[model samples]
Target chain A: MSESYEATVTDPVSAPMTCDSNPVEEWLRMDRMPHIWCPGCGIGTSVNCFTRAIEESSLDRKNIAIVSGIGCTGRVAGYLLLDSFHTTHGRALPFATGLKLASPKTKVVVYSGDGDLFAIGGNHFIHAARRNLDMTVLCVNNFNYGMTGGQVAPTTPEFAIASTTPYGSVERPFNLPYLAQSCGAVYVARWTVYHVKQLQRSIREALEKPGFTFIEMVAPCPTLFVRRNRLGDGLAALESYEENAVIKNGADTRECDLGMGGPIVCGKFVDIDRPSYLSNQVAHLRKVLGDRYVMPDAWQGVVQ
Target chain B: MNADPRGVLTGSHFLDGDHAAAEGALAAGANFSAGYPITPSTEVVERLAGRFPFTGGTFIQMEDELAASIAIQGAVWGGSKALTVTSGPGFSLMMEHLGYGIMTETPFVLVDVQRGGPSTGLPTMPAQADMMQARWGSHGDYEIIALAPSSPQECFNLMIRAFNLSEKYRTPVLLMMDECVGHMLERVVIPSPEKIQIEPRRYTRKGPDEQYWPYSLEECNNGDLVPPLTKVGEGHFPHITGLTHDDRGYPAMNAKSQAVLLGRLVDKIRNNADDIITIEEDGTDDADVIVVSYGITARVCQPAISRARAEGHKVGFLRLVTVWPFPEKRIRELAGRVSAFVVPEMNLGQIVREVERCSQGRPKVRGVTHAGGAVHDPEEIYNAIREVMG
Candidate 1:
């Protein structure tokens, strides 16, 4: 507790945020600001849209919990003034699933980057969706590992350049919308960071929806992915990025896969009602135990 | 805090070490468990799944050891006392999250029902091989509390101690039960809820208006108990990460910061070793040879010590209940008094090394070895004692 080893905080974030008139400021830890994100990074835009969605959502503010894995998108947990867990890399979903199961009423969200979700934690993603868990997963697909120097990602387009794939990636990218839909997500949506209003509205809608909602935000990693691929930086990348993106609300999830320099289909592809893991588990137990089965009051019977 | 009556079966029951451990967790006020079924540890989960529906407890069958381990951490931060059970292979998988939980300072219990293995050596058989693994398996220099039970009764009793230690320290407490002890059945007495004491998580006193730091200990009035824990839903906006962090729990990237962070992590356990370290000794006075053992091996040492005593060779028994702090000071004192220390274990040698290290070449230390398919023969242990005495 002494001042024995206080390191000179080289990048002590700008002066502590004072009482502010800004609404986003009310919901964010602005002192933790001047964030680690590069100047033209699309991650900050995605965070802006998310904070706006939280502001506009009808749910109680006290019931929200945010979880994030390791990456640029993962820092959202640190920025948000909500109950957040900055869990280990590729583990945000499982950790979020545990929180949702234990505190069923709390709305949990897993916000992370493409590599953290689809590469190391893809198995957990499929199983959580398959179970129809009552939570939302916001995957920011930046097409490369922004935190660990722009390595190629599962969502990176084939023939695109990355630090690991200096000569161009030779692998197929996972079409997230199709992946979420096929994995049994109750609601699936996608939008680029450029679509501010639409993206925020889509997040709000997903937040309202139940059972494994997934929203993939195609953000630009201007510092890493953009520079390495010779794509224009800052807003220039957003103006011309994923240019083939087409709005398709009800396209077949299979055909919605993103290909190299091909049409990028994005929309609220799947929205349907399905009982979540907790609800179904409760119902099944009730039917079997009848009056013997007692439902635990909130936060009583934590998930196994 | 007292045990929840709904979860406690307050009566004597004949139960195996694994089942006793499950009951112990319930009586210790653990409301949540996430685990993958593995041999020797499966009964702990199976018992909980069937019992939780009726006892207001929740048991989640996780996909793998990786999920099972981290899931418990989430539950803990969500204001629940949680734990996960696994054996050798699964315990190996849990190593990473064990480190994760330590770095984040999340309190939880993990029962590693020890089985023989460098890699899946024996599935159903017992091994005390994980003693070293429990101490150092997880990468990094953080400390953990571990317990070894010699019987089903101790399995139930020590489980509460394990949970209490974990709650008190905000560290992962390992109940290192070997396969033999986990499977062997015996009479276990469950006390009434009021009779069983449980450690409630210490919550910070600083109000919401005050800037709360998760690791700030300027107000830590007690040394045994670390900083008070703030739950995730408590609106503290508490940010915890696995990265080397400051007292605010914010990740810091420099070694000077890392040095301070790592120092606290290590010292929290090291400084409180006196209160955390526990060992049981019997018949040590005027003894020429003392046998050190734990888990089922401790029970196995009973006959060996008795045989040595019958032959008029002064023999003693030293049982390890809390293994992580290693009880080095106690071993050092005994080494100067006893002529030799004989250790018999299911593995070729694991904890015997600790005995050797603590002995400091002061006394002859010998080990009775086995490949772990079966328990050590009492006759072989008796011979080892005689040999060490000579």
Candidate 2:
């Protein structure tokens, strides 16, 4: 055979493209692929950033466990190649809280969506932060509930059209960063799908923090949020985020609220040190019991 | 297997049922518990909170019952033997997660210190009304093992059994305690660790190099139908979900997968009913009338049974220890010979329906129903037995 013909047959560059060549493929359940995400949905992009963050973090893959509640983002747990749990709707924070307490050496991440984390699971989110549980919560905020059609969510900005609020929502939306910071989260950040590098960096930083860390990634629900509000397609939504998002690290979280068709504030808002729930518990018990206090079996080597 | 000695108190003490249940959990080698404070059941967690620090156990007071229920499951996945305690209102809130546990085949114990309720009817009062709720509250066709403890001693004894059955079957086991039993003080003897047998969690023996499926029946080696569990950091990379899943524990939302998954979940408990069901019988060999009772009512029926026996009636007594597998075989066998069954319980007619169904019209079943707050009078139960034999 001629040299050109041999090169065409033998070169990897001329081979048919497969997902096996993708770097993130190792972190995902490729067997379960053909993911359920809809066309132009931004959740897949956020997940890509998450896989990159996991790769960059110093934590061992075997020592990391991901938990998710019922929503479109909840499916992230099932797709990840790790010890993952798809828990009951609105219970991911508490589930991860228990996992962290039981295996203090394991890095537990609660990956869920706006409605699953804020509406039904709102109480757990607030309490987990208030207690300063050692876990990271990555909330993919698409504004409305995307999994169950575009229903009005707690994070849905006022005057945005949703299936449950076809006449337009009148209730004010929750400012998530402000909520997390006020509830005693040691690390809080916000970014959009368009800001992939920043989002991945924020996730890595949050993973290294001890106490409860919250990161809100504002993504697009083109089939619902964008289409219903006439905000164009997913690409248009990313362009809008690129055009309007302001990066102001250390900005007061109270001023970080998002309104309908308004500028999106994106940056780290809170980073501080606080004793986590388990550490506080151990410290208090050791003080009271003195030599009688024995570290829990799971925390024997990890604590102290 | 023997329990861990650190968890065993190993002494005799006058304790309430709730406290004894806590000691029982410790003796069973439960290293983690998450619970919320509710009426009557609060003492169980209160005792655990006071003792867990010393025994190398972790007890968390979650925000609500829903959180507590799911938190224990997370701990189980993280390689801790875990449990959660609550009362009627809180137990209702935990129904969804109970179904989640059953769907995932997660082994954990739930202690429901029963109080009167459709919705918080009587918080501090005695009631056996939640018995049916414990069996059927979760919305699914699944079987769960539920045990009723009649005294503080039984509370300590049965909790260990509850944990063992849960691990053996890989299902949630309910420790059903009424307000009376939860609050009643009695002498409880806690055996030494060597004397107490504990079934360790059936963790998969497969190494990281081998493929391990979370729900694969092919991995079942003990002939019990339960697939061994895998811990989070074990490198099994198991995917556990509440959705109907295939043997690999991945969501298989189709009719065939649902049938296989739900069928196994139900059959694991039902098929093992012979080994799982426990009942106490007296004078049942030759009797014209049998009185059925459980929980506090079982103790109440004792005096009534003695009164009927004194009157020369061939009255037999049956006390249910494991209420859920319902002791159907024994009840049916006795029903073929007995003329009637007198069931005196605190509820309107919960387990009596089971007795009636099991008898299959072979015997007349009478339910001596009381609507909470107090135990049945021995005279009332005696009269029911007399009426059945009159």
Candidate 3:
């Protein structure tokens, strides 16, 4: 609706377009676009899938809140037409935890990047999972700190070239799915940006499930990660994913690690039910206090 | 508004400063507290953990102080009155989130039970070293309000005041209690809920269809600079960020935006210093010398001031109940009248600098500084007062 956005869409040389509506426009802050993402960056694609998943889920759109930390993918919260919080670096998980606990019925999602979540926010991630807090954690693993111009990250593949790791990364990358499962995440999944439909479906499934749900979207940083590592462009990265990616449901998360230029194992590796943090707290309190037990006002409507 | 009766204990009980503070927070309608355990401050959360179950509240022991600090801010946005308690080292970890809370204008209480520090100096001993840190620890040009309580009763009374002030201003308030005050057991009377005054959260009345901006000047009342808050999950769909932002709460990323945002953040407390400041004074009407102190040092200065007064030295006592605004006006007024001002604190002269700055070289200002691990000796403070008089 802004003049700048309209200016971008109207090209005098192009054929007259008849399409009047975009399906995702209803879920986006159209006025804020022209976003800052570089061309061929897969963060936009991942966001599209996420918005589609939210549309397909049973959650009330007004009741859904999204929180993000400092990164390129962290901008997703700002773009979304929902209650959004752009918090400090590596602090989104704990912020979302407070939001979810304070308003139990509200569906909270923490969306950030690998460097922001795994590298700096790893402690929060593990603790949030271990407590089985009810929230969805969607991480875009671009293998480098894209916003900070391609510094080395925790999800960066071993022996991969980066701004910091010019010779090669000597440290091992985290198998995120395995870490999520080990930390008691009830639902864990990973999908590349190339697998749009599958990623959308996985997100929808995670949104519906209870307890700590984590999905890692292995996106391409065309300007930074791909360029520095000689991995061609974003299109080439997608093409490589098409050729080397294996979709194996119920795969062992520990074996899903990716080496440089290796096969990317992607699937929903963990899905089991467990009592969430609030439920467990309520149950324990009810047993101890008997008739004196009172559910917190925030949890009253949902828990009873 | 009167507090909720369910949270009020409604009777007299012997309590430590920490327990009294916990009771005060609950009575002030703090239904959520996320804190990591640290020395001296651990008792506050331990009491909340035991009491929140019956009071229909939630207390989460977070993984660390960093998580605990920001988690409380999230809870505030989620439509809950919240707080987080910590000691010296943990308070250091919370500095970043304190800035975050200030930038977003999130109303919450951060109770810092002060202990020895620089880096974990003495976890079990008292120190007022964090006085400067409480005011300027966060990175940026912003202002915050801090209170110091010297007794269990003040802890109970001032914790409620702290939350009220936070809600009134829509900013984080610090209850700065040293280890001496936090662990000292004393008589505290929990008044009935109706007797306790509480400031309910200032929630915006705007509906979804209305044009509501979270940080707009339109949202703030004339002369009262705090904008009303909108709860998350409601229809407002507020976009809050730590970046220098416009009235709409979106990042503006420019100097003009930074000036506009930072100006209000600083002015809200500085302009309203008179309404926010609280000080207890005795016999300053005809005194040549004034002894200024806060926290545990204020209690220690009592006997010293009495001894000086008994000798006809005309020494007066001034206790800083609200320390952050520094009671500048009173200091300026008394600075012109008094010949000297003596400040006794557990730190190596943190607040004495403020006193000297406010005095503006008119009065001779002296700091009776002490390192942590113990309270200042009364004789030392008396000697400083006598020397300042000379």
Number of the top-ranking candidate, with lDDT as the measure: 2
TM-score, cand. 1 vs. native: 0.94
lDDT, candidate 1, at A103: 80
lDDT of 2 by residue, A16-124 (tens): 7776477899999999988898766889998899899989989999999999999999999999999999999999999998898889989999999999999999999
Q: In candidate 1, which residue ranges exceed 4 Å CA deviation?
A: A1-23, A299-304, B206-210, B222-225
Candidate 2, residue B48: Cα displacement in angstroms equals 0.5
lDDT string for model 3 (B115-164, tens) is 98889889999999999999999888888899999999999999999999
- Chain A TM-score of model 3 comes to 0.93
Among incorrect, acceptable, medium and high, the docking class of model 1 is medium
Predictions in order: lDDT: 0.85, 0.92, 0.91
What DockQ was computed for model 2? 0.72
lDDT (Cα, tens digit) per residue for candidate 1, span B9-98: 999999999999999998998888989989979999999888877776677887788888988888887788888999999999999999
Give the count of colliding residue pairs in each prediction: 2, 0, 0
Query: Could you give candidate 1's per-residue lDDT for residues A132-163 as a string of tens digits?
Result: 98899999998999999999999889899988
Where does model 3 exceed 4 Å of error?
A1-21
Sort all candidates by DockQ, best to worst. 3, 2, 1
lDDT of 3 at A208: 89
What is the Cα root-mean-square deviation between model 1 and the actual structure? 5.1
Report the number of the highest-DockQ candidate: 3
